[model samples]
Target: MSFNGNESSAISLAVATEMTSDYRTNNPNETKAHFFGKNKLMDILNQNGCVGIRAYYGIDADGNKQLVFVGADADEKDLYSGVILDMSAPCPSNCDNTSPLNG
Candidate 1:
């Protein structure tokens, strides 16, 4: 589902946490080097604290706009090396990306 700036921010945090935990559990081999590879995404995640900073532009299965999840961390290296997650949900008929916070 489409999310406004604020809603997107909230969802980003949730998704980042989920992804981080998943990585720690499922991909223990992951290291700081792997997380901080993407500079831009890592910067945004650091400033926003677990917010899902979109890495690429694309659409979901239902044709709804989707954003890539940027993992959480402070150091650019740490941030990029973290796991990426997906936070797409089906949009309701009345969904409004302009004001997703209302949802």
Candidate 2:
């Protein structure tokens, strides 16, 4: 299917909890989530020809997991030379402990 830049990715709370729970059960000691401000997300989306955003799994120098964001065109090509956003606040260090997704 071709990407028209719009995708519905919302999941029910129960599904989200289960997915996060599964990850925690297996990893035990990993970041549960990352926080990116709306401004940063909008900046990526505002890039020329940016129809969507793509995230890549990464590892920082400290061996902690990280996510790198970049703009993706409707053709599903990453705009590597365009704006990139990273350095997000990670869970454990910056998490909402009460959230089911973090539990």
Q: In TM-score terms, which candidate is top?
A: 2
What's the number of clashes in each of the models? 8, 0
lDDT of 1 at 22: 68
Model 2 spans > 4 angstroms off: none
Query: TM-scores, in order shown?
Result: 0.28, 0.93
The residue-by-residue lDDT of candidate 2 on 1-103, one tens digit each, is 5568777688999999999999999999888899999999999999989988889999999998999999988788899998898889998789898898987
Candidate 1 residue lDDT tens string, 35-83:
2235554445555445345455556686645556655432322245555
Q: Which clashing pairs does model 1 show?
A: 1-89, 34-81, 35-80, 35-81, 35-82, 36-77, 36-80, 36-81
Candidate 2 residue pairs that clash: none
Candidate 2, residue 103: Cα displacement in angstroms equals 1.5
